[model samples]
Target: MLRLRRPNASLVLRALLVVVLAATSAAANEAEKAPPDLARGARLYSDNCGRCHNARGPAEYSDAHWPLIVTHMRVIAGLPGEQARTIEAFLRASNNPPPPPRRLGRLAAVVPAAGLSGSELIERYGCRGCHVIGDAGGSIGPSLRGLFERRQADWIRVQIQTPREHNAKTLMPLYGLSDAETSAILEALRAAR
Candidate 1:
């Protein structure tokens, strides 16, 4: 005869936590290995899914649900793995848009990014949405890695000021960065390598 005892709840919870953390770490590691290009992802998502999925907002789906949905859609639409991954990244980012402006009587106030650190400003402006900084970001634009090494400060400044000057069809938004802000962002881009 043999007797079996079930694992205690605490033991089970600890096991579950370990499993969850391991999965999260693995996913993060995989993401860093070859980050998806968000700009391209958005375009692909629109192109492949716009007609059928237009009625549903991405926010309506759970984060965990998207990969599965994208997988199924990929099979149906014959999307390549790279394209599917890009679309997944874009969908994940779009799941939560930035919060609306704070209201003050008749005025709407924005939390200014003027004084944030270079990295913070980069995040605030969503530069990674189009250009890969280090191992992350979209592939729509040139990688910011070795940015300073390749482009002169003046040239980068011009690009920052008027992106269209560099590329006639550039999709980058003009941030109208102040001298200080511009310097900070440039420094950040330089350090991204």
Candidate 2:
């Protein structure tokens, strides 16, 4: 009688890893092939939409609302179907909300209350419509890429609290954020570096 040997655990694990890596690489290649051109979308938006009303940034609206708004705008503005779709893609990509913070469960007791990050606060307040944060945000306001390098914590806090105090002709509105919100945003900005 002939006996069969079991597969080695290490061999099985290596096979699985190879399969996973292959799948991941294939999916990444597919994605890269059809990547959306946000610059084209921005230009289209400026040329077409900016003709009438102020061209609102993508972050101004939620993902769900963008399709409807884009459809409406497409009809009103007489935009081509492909251009409309491209614009919609850009808006959806830009306004993509961050995932909700994970709950710590039992660890919550031991860990300090870590509030929302700077990016989160910025999104919550729709500041991306005016300011550029990283590669995703708009350019109506100043780019906050190196905000900490230019301004101090107190200055930032004061500017958020009272925009006019910092700049005489600032278009930024007073958000009237609470002290906790202010501190959380400030901490996030500091931690970003």
Candidate 3:
């Protein structure tokens, strides 16, 4: 009978350690790779979440909380795994986006306009799709220029919140504008030349 020498215990242990180290190094490298596509995530978020709720900026939530929140929302919104992951990646990336580029002759950071700006509110509700505001806006409805001169502030507010109340034949849709949004729109219209 031929006798076989037993394997060396130290050699076996060293081999195991090398394998472990290699695995760890590979995992670290994977972790350091570029993050997922944030633009895709933003689109996913807007298409799904923005339908019912305001599409809040990603910086609203912390990195740790985003995964959990998005995971929960995924089920409620019936989102697929890939879409949820993409949105989570976008939220993580946007949580701390780079600062805006510096502009020449720009005034030192003035206080931002309170609440959503008028232009933002208009765009958000697709007001330009039906009404002409300035040089370039929609013409389906009456021009928004000199609206304040024609309509009272209260009338504008009422029309925005309840369009049909003012005109039975009005094609304008009610946006259920918040008080802040209403105020901002009014301010913007008033400031328009």
Which sequence of candidate numbers ranks them by lDDT, best first? 1, 2, 3
Question: Candidate 3 at residue 22, lDDT?
Answer: 100
Q: Write the per-residue lDDT of candidate 3 for residues 58-90, one digit (tens) a residue.
A: 556777889899999988989886678777876
Single out the weakest 10-residue window by summed lDDT for candidate 3.
Answer: 103-112
Please provide, for model 1 over 60-103, each residue's C-alpha lDDT reduced to its tens digit, 9 standing for 90 to 100: 67667988999998899888866788778767665643343234
* TM-score of candidate 1 against the unseen true structure: 0.43
TM-scores of all candidate predictions against the true structure: 0.43, 0.44, 0.41
lDDT (0-100) at residue 179 of candidate 1? 59
**Which pairs clash in the backbone of model 2?**
none
Show where candidate 2 strays beyond 4 Å.
Answer: 1-115
lDDT of each: 0.69, 0.68, 0.67
Clashing residue pairs in candidate 1, if any?
none
lDDT of 2 by residue, 1-193 (tens): 9989999999999999999999978865665577666556554565677678876756577889998999999999899866776677667765643443355465442323665665577666655555655665565567777899998879998887667698865655555555566666677666654
